[model samples]
Target: MPDTTLSNCVRDAATQAAGLPRRRSVPVSLIAAVAALGGLLFGYDTGIISAALLFIGDTFALDDTVKQIVTAAIVAGALVGCLAAGP
Candidate 1:
Protein backbone atom coordinates (compact mmCIF):
# COMPACT_ATOMS: atom_id res chain seq x y z
CA MET A 1 0.00 0.00 0.00
CA PRO A 2 1.02 3.56 -0.61
CA ASP A 3 2.20 5.58 2.43
CA THR A 4 -0.84 7.24 4.09
CA THR A 5 1.15 10.39 4.88
CA LEU A 6 2.26 10.79 1.26
CA SER A 7 -1.26 10.19 -0.08
CA ASN A 8 -2.75 12.76 2.35
CA CYS A 9 -0.06 15.30 1.38
CA VAL A 10 -0.81 14.84 -2.31
CA ARG A 11 -4.58 15.03 -1.75
CA ASP A 12 -4.25 18.22 0.24
CA ALA A 13 -1.94 19.72 -2.32
CA ALA A 14 -4.44 18.89 -5.09
CA THR A 15 -7.24 20.50 -3.10
CA GLN A 16 -5.23 23.67 -2.51
CA ALA A 17 -4.28 23.80 -6.16
CA ALA A 18 -8.01 23.86 -7.08
CA GLY A 19 -8.24 27.31 -5.32
CA LEU A 20 -11.84 27.02 -4.10
CA PRO A 21 -12.97 29.73 -1.69
CA ARG A 22 -14.43 28.88 1.73
CA ARG A 23 -18.17 29.28 2.28
CA ARG A 24 -19.25 32.57 3.84
CA SER A 25 -21.66 33.00 6.74
CA VAL A 26 -24.98 34.82 6.21
CA PRO A 27 -25.65 38.03 8.14
CA VAL A 28 -28.05 37.83 11.07
CA SER A 29 -29.95 40.94 9.96
CA LEU A 30 -30.62 39.49 6.51
CA ILE A 31 -31.82 36.22 8.00
CA ALA A 32 -34.09 38.09 10.39
CA ALA A 33 -35.50 40.20 7.58
CA VAL A 34 -36.31 37.16 5.46
CA ALA A 35 -38.00 35.43 8.43
CA ALA A 36 -40.03 38.55 9.15
CA LEU A 37 -41.15 38.81 5.55
CA GLY A 38 -42.23 35.18 5.54
CA GLY A 39 -44.25 35.71 8.68
CA LEU A 40 -45.90 38.79 7.23
CA LEU A 41 -46.87 36.96 4.05
CA PHE A 42 -48.27 34.04 6.00
CA GLY A 43 -50.35 36.38 8.11
CA TYR A 44 -51.71 38.08 5.03
CA ASP A 45 -52.57 34.73 3.46
CA THR A 46 -54.60 33.60 6.51
CA GLY A 47 -56.24 36.98 6.80
CA ILE A 48 -57.38 36.84 3.17
CA ILE A 49 -58.67 33.32 3.60
CA SER A 50 -60.63 34.36 6.63
CA ALA A 51 -62.05 37.34 4.82
CA ALA A 52 -63.07 35.27 1.79
CA LEU A 53 -64.56 32.37 3.73
CA LEU A 54 -68.04 33.84 3.55
CA PHE A 55 -67.99 34.05 -0.23
CA ILE A 56 -66.33 30.65 -0.51
CA GLY A 57 -68.91 29.11 1.78
CA ASP A 58 -71.76 30.63 -0.23
CA THR A 59 -70.27 29.39 -3.49
CA PHE A 60 -69.33 25.92 -2.29
CA ALA A 61 -71.99 25.47 0.42
CA LEU A 62 -69.31 24.41 2.90
CA ASP A 63 -70.51 23.66 6.42
CA ASP A 64 -68.87 24.58 9.70
CA THR A 65 -66.79 21.39 9.87
CA VAL A 66 -65.50 21.71 6.33
CA LYS A 67 -64.73 25.38 6.82
CA GLN A 68 -62.75 24.54 9.93
CA ILE A 69 -60.87 21.90 7.97
CA VAL A 70 -60.15 24.35 5.17
CA THR A 71 -58.76 26.88 7.62
CA ALA A 72 -56.61 24.29 9.35
CA ALA A 73 -55.32 22.74 6.13
CA ILE A 74 -52.93 25.57 5.32
CA VAL A 75 -51.38 25.38 8.79
CA ALA A 76 -51.14 21.59 8.61
CA GLY A 77 -49.46 21.69 5.21
CA ALA A 78 -46.98 24.30 6.41
CA LEU A 79 -46.15 22.14 9.44
CA VAL A 80 -45.55 19.11 7.23
CA GLY A 81 -43.34 21.07 4.83
CA CYS A 82 -41.26 22.56 7.66
CA LEU A 83 -40.77 19.16 9.29
CA ALA A 84 -39.81 17.53 6.01
CA ALA A 85 -37.28 20.24 5.17
CA GLY A 86 -35.77 20.46 8.65
CA PRO A 87 -32.23 19.26 9.29
Candidate 2:
Protein backbone atom coordinates (compact mmCIF):
# COMPACT_ATOMS: atom_id res chain seq x y z
CA MET A 1 0.00 0.00 0.00
CA PRO A 2 2.73 2.46 0.95
CA ASP A 3 4.79 1.36 -2.02
CA THR A 4 1.95 2.15 -4.42
CA THR A 5 1.52 5.61 -2.91
CA LEU A 6 5.24 6.25 -3.16
CA SER A 7 5.27 5.09 -6.76
CA ASN A 8 2.37 7.39 -7.60
CA CYS A 9 4.17 10.34 -6.02
CA VAL A 10 7.32 9.60 -7.98
CA ARG A 11 5.35 9.24 -11.20
CA ASP A 12 3.57 12.53 -10.58
CA ALA A 13 6.81 14.33 -9.89
CA ALA A 14 8.40 12.86 -13.02
CA THR A 15 5.39 13.95 -15.08
CA GLN A 16 5.55 17.47 -13.72
CA ALA A 17 9.28 17.70 -14.28
CA ALA A 18 8.94 16.46 -17.84
CA GLY A 19 6.02 18.80 -18.65
CA LEU A 20 7.91 21.99 -17.82
CA PRO A 21 8.98 24.15 -20.77
CA ARG A 22 12.72 24.54 -21.12
CA ARG A 23 12.81 27.58 -23.39
CA ARG A 24 14.52 29.74 -20.72
CA SER A 25 16.89 27.01 -19.62
CA VAL A 26 20.10 28.99 -19.94
CA PRO A 27 19.70 30.58 -16.52
CA VAL A 28 18.88 27.17 -15.09
CA SER A 29 21.97 25.69 -16.73
CA LEU A 30 24.15 28.47 -15.34
CA ILE A 31 22.74 27.93 -11.86
CA ALA A 32 23.36 24.19 -12.12
CA ALA A 33 26.92 24.75 -13.34
CA VAL A 34 27.68 27.09 -10.49
CA ALA A 35 26.23 24.66 -7.99
CA ALA A 36 28.28 21.82 -9.52
CA LEU A 37 31.45 23.89 -9.42
CA GLY A 38 30.84 24.68 -5.78
CA GLY A 39 30.60 20.94 -5.15
CA LEU A 40 33.87 20.38 -7.00
CA LEU A 41 35.58 23.05 -4.94
CA PHE A 42 34.20 21.49 -1.79
CA GLY A 43 35.44 18.06 -2.87
CA TYR A 44 38.85 19.37 -3.77
CA ASP A 45 39.22 21.18 -0.48
CA THR A 46 38.04 18.16 1.47
CA GLY A 47 40.29 15.71 -0.39
CA ILE A 48 43.41 17.85 -0.16
CA ILE A 49 44.00 16.72 3.40
CA SER A 50 44.36 13.10 2.22
CA ALA A 51 47.54 13.98 0.36
CA ALA A 52 48.92 16.38 2.95
CA LEU A 53 47.83 14.70 6.20
CA LEU A 54 50.93 12.59 6.67
CA PHE A 55 53.13 15.51 5.86
CA ILE A 56 51.10 17.69 8.14
CA GLY A 57 51.46 15.21 11.00
CA ASP A 58 55.09 14.47 10.34
CA THR A 59 55.97 18.10 9.87
CA PHE A 60 54.21 18.97 13.07
CA ALA A 61 55.02 15.66 14.86
CA LEU A 62 51.44 15.45 15.99
CA ASP A 63 50.01 12.64 18.09
CA ASP A 64 46.88 10.62 17.16
CA THR A 65 44.43 12.97 18.91
CA VAL A 66 46.18 15.98 17.44
CA LYS A 67 46.13 14.38 14.01
CA GLN A 68 42.38 13.90 14.31
CA ILE A 69 42.06 17.51 15.35
CA VAL A 70 44.11 18.71 12.38
CA THR A 71 42.13 16.58 9.94
CA ALA A 72 38.83 17.75 11.42
CA ALA A 73 39.99 21.34 11.07
CA ILE A 74 40.07 20.92 7.30
CA VAL A 75 36.43 19.79 7.30
CA ALA A 76 35.58 22.65 9.60
CA GLY A 77 37.26 25.06 7.22
CA ALA A 78 35.18 23.66 4.36
CA LEU A 79 32.05 24.19 6.40
CA VAL A 80 33.15 27.73 7.12
CA GLY A 81 33.93 28.28 3.45
CA CYS A 82 30.47 27.09 2.47
CA LEU A 83 28.87 29.21 5.14
CA ALA A 84 30.85 32.21 4.00
CA ALA A 85 29.82 31.59 0.39
CA GLY A 86 26.24 30.93 1.56
CA PRO A 87 23.29 29.39 -0.29
Candidate 3:
Protein backbone atom coordinates (compact mmCIF):
# COMPACT_ATOMS: atom_id res chain seq x y z
CA MET A 1 0.00 0.00 0.00
CA PRO A 2 1.14 3.57 -0.78
CA ASP A 3 2.14 5.75 2.25
CA THR A 4 -0.37 8.61 1.83
CA THR A 5 0.51 10.18 5.16
CA LEU A 6 4.20 10.45 4.29
CA SER A 7 3.40 11.89 0.87
CA ASN A 8 1.12 14.56 2.34
CA CYS A 9 3.72 15.50 4.98
CA VAL A 10 6.40 15.84 2.29
CA ARG A 11 4.14 17.97 0.10
CA ASP A 12 3.22 20.26 2.99
CA ALA A 13 6.87 20.73 3.98
CA ALA A 14 7.83 21.52 0.39
CA THR A 15 5.09 24.10 0.07
CA GLN A 16 6.09 25.81 3.33
CA ALA A 17 9.78 25.87 2.36
CA ALA A 18 8.99 27.37 -1.06
CA GLY A 19 7.72 30.61 0.60
CA LEU A 20 4.86 31.18 -1.86
CA PRO A 21 3.29 33.89 0.34
CA ARG A 22 6.26 36.25 -0.05
CA ARG A 23 5.81 36.21 -3.84
CA ARG A 24 2.78 38.48 -3.62
CA SER A 25 4.61 41.23 -1.66
CA VAL A 26 4.41 43.22 -4.84
CA PRO A 27 1.13 43.02 -6.70
CA VAL A 28 1.27 41.34 -10.11
CA SER A 29 -1.10 43.87 -11.63
CA LEU A 30 1.14 46.79 -10.71
CA ILE A 31 4.16 45.08 -12.21
CA ALA A 32 2.24 44.36 -15.40
CA ALA A 33 1.00 47.95 -15.63
CA VAL A 34 4.54 49.34 -15.36
CA ALA A 35 5.79 46.92 -18.00
CA ALA A 36 2.91 47.77 -20.31
CA LEU A 37 3.55 51.48 -19.88
CA GLY A 38 7.20 51.07 -20.85
CA GLY A 39 6.23 49.12 -23.98
CA LEU A 40 3.61 51.68 -24.94
CA LEU A 41 6.09 54.54 -24.65
CA PHE A 42 8.65 52.67 -26.75
CA GLY A 43 6.09 52.03 -29.46
CA TYR A 44 4.89 55.62 -29.35
CA ASP A 45 8.41 57.01 -29.76
CA THR A 46 9.13 54.66 -32.70
CA GLY A 47 5.90 55.54 -34.49
CA ILE A 48 6.40 59.27 -33.96
CA ILE A 49 9.89 59.11 -35.42
CA SER A 50 8.76 56.99 -38.38
CA ALA A 51 5.98 59.44 -39.24
CA ALA A 52 8.13 62.51 -38.60
CA LEU A 53 10.94 61.28 -40.83
CA LEU A 54 8.83 61.84 -43.94
CA PHE A 55 8.07 65.45 -43.08
CA ILE A 56 11.60 66.06 -41.82
CA GLY A 57 13.07 64.77 -45.06
CA ASP A 58 10.72 66.86 -47.14
CA THR A 59 11.35 69.99 -45.10
CA PHE A 60 15.12 69.64 -45.10
CA ALA A 61 15.44 68.34 -48.66
CA LEU A 62 17.55 65.52 -47.25
CA ASP A 63 19.55 63.24 -49.50
CA ASP A 64 19.46 59.45 -49.07
CA THR A 65 22.77 59.48 -47.20
CA VAL A 66 21.62 62.16 -44.73
CA LYS A 67 18.31 60.35 -44.16
CA GLN A 68 20.12 57.12 -43.44
CA ILE A 69 22.48 58.86 -41.05
CA VAL A 70 19.59 60.37 -39.14
CA THR A 71 17.92 57.00 -38.75
CA ALA A 72 21.23 55.36 -37.80
CA ALA A 73 21.86 58.01 -35.13
CA ILE A 74 18.61 57.17 -33.36
CA VAL A 75 19.42 53.44 -33.44
CA ALA A 76 22.97 54.02 -32.23
CA GLY A 77 21.76 56.18 -29.37
CA ALA A 78 19.33 53.46 -28.32
CA LEU A 79 22.10 50.84 -28.50
CA VAL A 80 24.40 52.94 -26.34
CA GLY A 81 21.66 53.52 -23.79
CA CYS A 82 20.93 49.80 -23.65
CA LEU A 83 24.60 48.99 -23.16
CA ALA A 84 25.00 51.58 -20.40
CA ALA A 85 21.95 50.24 -18.56
CA GLY A 86 23.57 46.77 -18.25
CA PRO A 87 21.86 43.35 -18.05
Q: Pick the candidate with the highest lDDT.
A: 1
lDDT of 2 by residue, 1-87 (tens): 454688677776777889953244789899999989988987897688777887978888878898788788888987797799886
Please state the error at residue 37 of candidate 3 in Å: 2.1
lDDT of 1 by residue, 14-75 (tens): 76789854333579778988999989988998899898899989999999999999999988
Give the TM-scores of the predictions, in the order they appear: 0.62, 0.63, 0.54
Summed backbone clashes in each candidate are 0, 0, 0
| Prediction 2 global C-alpha lDDT | 0.80
Worst 10 residues of 3 by lDDT: 19-28
Rank all candidate structures by their lDDT, best first, as comma-separated numbers.
Answer: 1, 3, 2
Model 1 residue runs over 4 Å out of place are 1-26
lDDT by candidate, in order shown: 0.85, 0.80, 0.80
Q: Give the poorly placed runs of model 2, Cα more than 4 Å off.
A: 1-24
Candidate 2 lDDT at 85 equals 82
